[model samples]
Target: MSLLNNVFYFQNGIGVLANVFLLLFYIFIILCHRPKPMDLISCQLTFSHTVMLLTGGVVWVTDIFESLHVDNDIKCKTSFYINRVMRGLSICITCLLSMFQAVTISPSTSFLANFKLKLKKNIIYAFFYICSLNLSLYSYLIFYVGGLTNVSETNQMKVTKSCSLLPTNYIIRALNLTVTTSIDIFLVGVMLVTSAYIVLILFRHQRQHKHLHSLSHPRSSPEKKATQTILLLVTFFVVMYWVDFIISSTAVLLWMYNPVIQSVQKFVLNVYPTVTPLVQISSDNRIIKILKNIRSKYHQIL
Candidate 1:
């Protein structure tokens, strides 16, 4: 087996395990939490991330098998479709998460303060709409290219009997990835900037002894903790995934000339979804509270 195959198997194994844990984590949140607006949204986001990882794992494993001369066309298409859809939905969920945090941290005196109440009930519907929109958008693109196939006995993308779509066809692919990456980067930037500004402004207001109604509340600890968690989440998202985005985009623009770079980039990109949920689990206080409550309840029952 080649180095690439070894890496692929190792990464897929990690994703499979991570997704299993994430699935269980989401179920625990759903069953244990009192269904706060953030809890429900986060539950969906965790579930989406798990599905995305599972789909990516399938793609990685299929690539390894194809490298070894075992090919399955149907699995290729299924993995391609599922991975694209789930990945797209995962991006949308992250956007929603940022927006959710932004609003949660927004001052009650702001014009958009009422938005918090309005959005509380619509999160599930919004997630469904985004998923449906992304599915339709990418499903249409899949028809333009031949799904995955065997590379050939030599195991080279160039030596394959299967052919790629013309460079003109690649325009849509490039455009789609560029636009998606741009949006993801932009939202992350906005989330970080806005969250930082909000926290700073709050600090300044407190320093000045300004009579902000929201900050006067005694329950400010949880609110501040949530804000800090969101900021950390945004930081982790940018740090971990930015390299993958750059590497993947560079590979596509180079037209896949560097197979070694491409393989490594794909591996990093696939691992990101798995890592993101883990970040959320460790960083979010609410999740920690739920876990502690679960442990306590289990002990009581025992």
Candidate 2:
């Protein structure tokens, strides 16, 4: 195995392990506590991240095996499509979470206040519809993505293999790209705008209460801290999403001129899935309390 492959293998393995930890931790929290809207959304996000990591990890492992002349086109294509779907679902869930936070913190007299009240009542239904929509939209992958085919045989006994889109029609390709790009752009734009609004609200509140004691100001509110965390999460997701988008777009435009581009794109795609759980846990009070309890018990035992 090449050094680069080894590095990716290690990275993916770590991601898988981290996601597993997050999944278990989230499940435990949900089971032990009264589930709030944010907690439920977080659980869904963690589940999506776990699936993304597992599917992507499988593809990476398959790549390593392929380097050793082991070919499994079916497994690779299946994992690839599943990973793509999970990635999209993760993005949508993150966007939803940001929107929820935005609504939660909306001013009582603001226009969104009534919508926020309605949204709280139907949050579960909203989540169900979001998951169903993403699943249905990404179902196109099953039709277009296929197993690897032998492209060429080199004189050195090396065989080149690739799993490519089945549709050769330019219209199909264009339609696919257009739909995917539109969805990504719309959701990302919502996340950015909503997060910006939340930040502006907090900033204005802080400024307005600058003379007040910390306890009296909304600046010290838990809602403000949660909003800040969600904003940070959204910011990180946007950065990673655009980086992956740029790399993938460049690779497509260049048409496989640089193999390194593909590797970088894969790495970039995994970044959010790997890091999101850590970020969520860091901002989660329940997780913090659980950890503190464990620490206390450990100290007493010691």
What lDDT score goes with residue 242 in model 2? 92
List clashing residue pairs in candidate 1. Answer: none
Top candidate, metric TM-score: 2
TM-score for each candidate, following the candidate numbering: 0.73, 0.86
RMSD of 2: 4.1
The reply for model 1, stretches above 4 Å from the true place, is 1-19, 28-33, 58-71, 144-170, 178-182, 205-219, 284-302
lDDT of each: 0.64, 0.75
State how far residue 211 of model 1 sits from its true place (Å): 12
Instruction: List, residue by residue over 1-302, the lDDT tens digit for candidate 2.
Output: 25655666566777777778878876876798676788778878888888887766555566666687754656555666777878888899999899999888888888888887687778789878987887788787776666545433221111113555453455665677778889999999999899889989988888777766555866455677788889988999999999988876554433343445555666788888777777777777777888899999999999
Give each model's clash number.
Answer: 0, 0
RMSD (Cα, Å) for all candidates, in order, is: 5.3, 4.1
